[model samples]
Target: MSALVDMNAKSGNLERALKLFEEMPKRVYRLSKFSGCSIATLLKVCKTTEHLHHLHARIIRKGLEQDQFLIAEFITLSNSLASLNYSSSVFDRVISPNIFLWNSLIRGYCQKRCFQDVLSVFIRLKRQACLPDNYTFPSLIKACSSLCNVEGGKSIHGSVVRHGFEACVFVGTSLIDMYGKCGHIDDARKVFDEMTERNVVSWTAMVVGYVTVGDVVEAKKLFDAMPQRNVASWNAMIQGFVKLGDLSSARGIFDSMPEKNVVSFTTMIDGYAKSGDMVSARFLFDQSLDKDLVAWSALISGYVQNGQPNAALNFFLEMESMNVKPDEFILVSLMSACSQLGSLELAQWIDSYVSKSSINIQQDHVIAALVDMNAKSGNMERALKWFEEMPKRDLVSYCSMIQGLSIHGQGAEAIRLFNRMLTEGLVPDEVAFTIILTACSHAGLVDEGWHYFRSMKHKFCISPSPDHYACMVDLLSRSGHVKAAHDLIKSMPVEPHAGAWGALLGACKLYSDSDLAEIVANRLFELEPRNAANYVLLSNIYAAAERWIDVSLVRNKMRERGVRKIPGCSQI
Candidate 1:
């Protein structure tokens, strides 16, 4: 009977094995090491815990629980399911775990992103007098990459050399990847150079490394030099072009691919949308015959990002009619669209769906999106309701709260939250400072604005970007110090964007300073020739100053440039 079970299980007839086990008297079956190993193999194919438990019990009943091979197999299966705790429990049961067992446990922990645990396991592996292998170094180095511990990874690189596997092609590829992910591109380059044998994976890893560091020029150069190219290498190049916003290059390669996968089309769609070419984006979407969930998500997200939120929502409805299950990306995209439309009813519907979602959107992320949706839709009270109920808060939650408060003219409240963020040790990033600065500027709190502005560089070490400078200019200008704002623009280390000059021009219009407005307008025109707002702002300033002749000249320039004001939009 045990032989029959082993034969059936080994032959991939698990159902027959299971039926045979059930039909036999439980105590009558005497299973051997091979039969136990066969059941363990069957455990690999079992998806449900119920069958797994039955097999586990059968193994113990047959007194084969101490089979080292079977135990190792159990550990591998646990990790494959991402149940690292189960792997650990199985490892604890191993009376004499060899190097292979240690490596398996470490690899599983690495997959869980428990980098510290991976290191701890490595230390334990060494203490057990088991020499780490080439397989071991790759997993350990990956953990170092995940932790961004280049120093630790370099030390592991030393171990690879000590073990005489430094020149090994597979280990070399893993090293290049690890260094690249850890932000050590130079180190990655050094390894790539010394390798006497380079495969497609090694070259691709180098390309991806350059891409990850925002050095697309280097990535492209390396990509062009590869002796042979695989689809993955081509995809890496496509990704590099997308990151560089060279949509033309990305599309060119995408067009030339011998074969296209779902990832290829989705990346192109996302690239076009990011570059603000919605027409091209939709053309690609309509052409895709196999619109997988990710492809659908890319199109849907593109519409919302390009500000056609209503169109995005309508298309989502169409997707639903096709029975395509919505993922978290689609749900979040819908939330943003509903928020932009300020349809509280729709936002409310999404909230219900979130609670019932089988996909398990992280609690904090879902709550943050809900809060942002409500806040953007002009439902501050409801926004507060979800925000206050959040179990925890992250950077996005804080940013959305401050931005929502600023947009609603709750400047005081926004500043209060910012101070609270500081008190809680939540170091504000660039976006956080921009939101608070805009809030202070909007509220006309010049003194507080100046304090925060100076603190941005002096205290926070955040060098003010153009957006921050614009907020400061607007703040000073709004407070009746147009001259100070102009001087500040002159003092800017970086070139002022149109927003800064536009703010200064608006202030000049308020004070009827046509002379200063004329100077600023010319710069604005030169900086952003096609921006109608600048032309309109300059004309308005001239009119306020009773400079009809200057206003006429501005109108002529707008006509020559064929610039027209965008139609106004009002939230219903």
Candidate 2:
């Protein structure tokens, strides 16, 4: 039975092994019949916390609780299966732990991103007089790096020197990485310079460190000076140039590389996408032999960002036809494209696909995109349902819901939700204030609008942007405050944007104030020379007042400027 259990566990058949283990006692074969290797195999193949607990109890009943090797293996495996607390509880009961046991627990903590606990354990190790080996400082330094605890990292570096492990190549590389990540690139370089020997990783760490600090010049110098180069080093240089918006330079490095991988292609593609060069982005994407999900996402989003929503959807179809499952990011991009197109049919298809697919509906970003898509598609009820179903409402989700309400002219509900967001302790940013102010304009909430507007710069210290000014103008105009709206536009500290003028002009048309309409229209003509709506609005204003000659002049202005009115379309 013991051999059968071992065989089943080794074959990755947890159900059979667990069933056989449960039947072991009835067969008169105790757990002692299982070797430590056999027991370790069971630990490795544990399917759940329940199975782990049952196995642990059996190991304890067999008097192997203090078996150091078995306990170490359990802690390591538990890092992946159970929680770190389980590993901590198991570690606490060990009477005399060797260095291997200490390192295992520290490694588990590091893996779980419990950086402060790693420091706590290292402190305890010092008090216990257990000498740390070369394996010790790497995880400890990594903990410090993750926490950005440069002081702690420096202290650990001193200990590494005292323990004579500073000369170890692996330890030196970790120190270099730690210093680099912590924005102490000079210190990283110093460590690299002092090292008697360095590997490709050590050199790459230094290059990446320089890239992190935006010192691509020095990074390129180091890249040129390296005795050898790997794909990581090449990718780092490409990323540096791409970040600085120097796509030409990035492409230059990419073209010079002897080898190119998915990362290299993805970085360059993203650069071209951001620079609005979708032709180059698509060209590179098609040229790459290895197209991963990230590469596909980059190209799809690039098309969407470059104002090619149909292209994004088409590529998404291509990816699906090729058997590539879309992840959350790609799904979010698709939702954005559908929202841009304002296609209720496409939005419904995306919603249905999400329901039938493996994507997590509970994911916050995916849910947020779904909310936006449904709202833009004119399905407010579905948008509200998703908003209320969010497991945890983040600021982005709140903004999405509030904007949905604003666009649907449910301004009162938008204001209520904005207040709810405040009550829940989310401080509104510039984007939130802009959306809320637009809601006020749409719903004609003047006093509430001014209150939030003043609070933006006075209470939250967020200066009102041009969009805020435009919303305020629209709000006053909608309320028959034409003179007040014009005054506000004139007093704007920043240059009044075309939106502010457009709002006031709209009011002129509404009130048939042709004189002020002509003035606002002339300014808009200078600002947006090719805007057919501005010329048409001005012409309509003149026509409404029976000024036939002035209306002809406005139409002639459109002809002179060669501005053509785009025919409008309606969704079914």
Candidate 3:
């Protein structure tokens, strides 16, 4: 009967194996005498959480709960099935866990990105005097790297050296990656230099370390010096140059590569798109044979970035026609294009498609884009519904919703939401502050604007940036406090930007203060001589006061500077 269970389990017929195992005790078979291999096989074939618990109960009944191998495999399988809590519970049942059990728990936590938990488990492992082996440090160091906890990584490195595992290439490679990711490239280099044995991964880690710190020059030198290079190493070098906006250099390397994968093609496409060289981006995109979702996303994102929303949408259609599924990333890019175009028809189609296709629109990024798109398309009701229904409102979602409210001139409501975000313990960043300040300016909330502005510097310790100052200037100017706005601009610690002057000049036109307008316009003319709007604005201010001569003079100056007023057009 035990052999039958083993054969059935090994053959992947878990249902049959489970039935036989359950009938064993009812048929007077000795459960205690069941072979460990058969039991291990049964555990391997177990699919659902219910079955796992049932087997665990049987193991406990048979007094095999403490079987180290069985418990270790149980813990591992539980984690693999996304049951970290269950894995932890099983580990807790072991009265005397060996190093293997401790390592298993640590690895599970690391896989789940529970970095602090990994560290906590390591501390417990030490308290129990369970010696960690080479398998332990890689995951443990990776947790530190993911957290960017250099101090924690350094402590782990000390442990690795103490355990005499530094010479192990795998441990050394992890240490190098940790130091590199933590912005300690020099320390990473030190680890790389000390390693007596190095493999492709070790060298790749060092190469990537240089790339992360924006040292592409040094990275290239190392790349050239490598005894051999893999596709990842090549990709890293290209990515470095692309980030630096050295597309020509990136292309040179791309053309030189003996092999080019999808990542290689996608990286170049992204670079060209960002540089506004959409033509070249499409050329490389077409050159790639393997067009995965990532590659398609790259092209679509590039079109969006290049202000070609229609092109992006058409490509999305092409993707669908090819039977390629769209993920959250592509959806976000498409939504951004819709936001820019403000096409209600397009927005509705996308919303309906997402619903019918069963895409997970509730993902934070996707929902954030949806909120922004709906608001931009003049569908505030749906936008607000989506915002309110979010299972978790992260900072990005809050910012998007707040910006949408600001766009609709619902300043008071935006402020309320901002306060709600504060109550939720989401510390507002600089961008959040800028949005709220702009919201206050638009609503003409003078007192509230002053309060948040001072709070930014005093309470939040966030220094008021130029954008914040510009918001305040516009707020004061709109409230008929032109002199106060001018005084604030003069008192600015940083050099006053054109936005501050522009706001005051616009206010001058409202109040018909020709002298102040002339002064602000002259300053702007000096700062932004090629800005036709400044000249046109000054001309309007002079013309308002019936100063035709000055208007003519402004026009003459524009003619002299050869500045042409660029006509504005609306996008449907």
Best of the candidates, TM-score: 2
Q: After superposition, how far is residue 272 of candidate 1 from its true place, in Å?
A: 1.6
Q: What is candidate 1's CA lDDT for residue 273?
A: 78
RMSD of 2: 4.4
Task: Please provide, for model 1 over 1-572, each residue's C-alpha lDDT reduced to its tens digit, 9 standing for 90 to 100.
Answer: 76787678777777788878767665554646556656665776766656666776776677766776776776777776636876797687777787777887987888778899999999888787788888898888888888888998899899899989988898999899998887789999999999999999999999999989989889989988999888888898899899889999999989998888777888888898777787888898888777888878887888888899988988899998999899888888889888788786787777787778786655666778888998876678878888878888777888888888888889999888888888878888888888888999999989889999999899989999999999999999998899999999999999999899989988898888889998999999999999999999888878877889988999999999999889899999
Model 3 per-residue lDDT tens digits across residues 1-572? 87888899989888889788777754343444454566788888888887777777777766776778778888887887747888898899898898888888898998888999999999998998889999999999999999999989999999999999999999999999999888899999999999999998999999999999999999999999999999999999999999999999999999999999989999998889889898898898889998778878888898998899999999999889988899889988999999999888889888777767768877777888888898888777888898898899888788888887888889999899999999999988899999999999999999999999999979999999888999999999999999999999989999889999999999999998999999999999999999999999999999989999999999999999999999999998
List the pairs of residues colliding in candidate 1.
Answer: none
What is the TM-score of each predicted model, taking all chains together?
0.72, 0.84, 0.78
Root mean square deviation (Cα) for candidate 3: 4.7
Model 2, position 323, has a per-residue lDDT of 96
Off by over 4 Å in 3: 1-3, 21-34, 92-97, 355-363, 390-560, 563-572
TM-score of 1: 0.72
Q: State the lDDT of candidate 2 residue by residue for 185-267, as single tens digits.
A: 88999999999989999999999999999999999999999999999999999999999999999999999999999999999
Residue 179 in model 1: lDDT: 89
Q: Which residue pairs in candidate 2 collide?
A: none
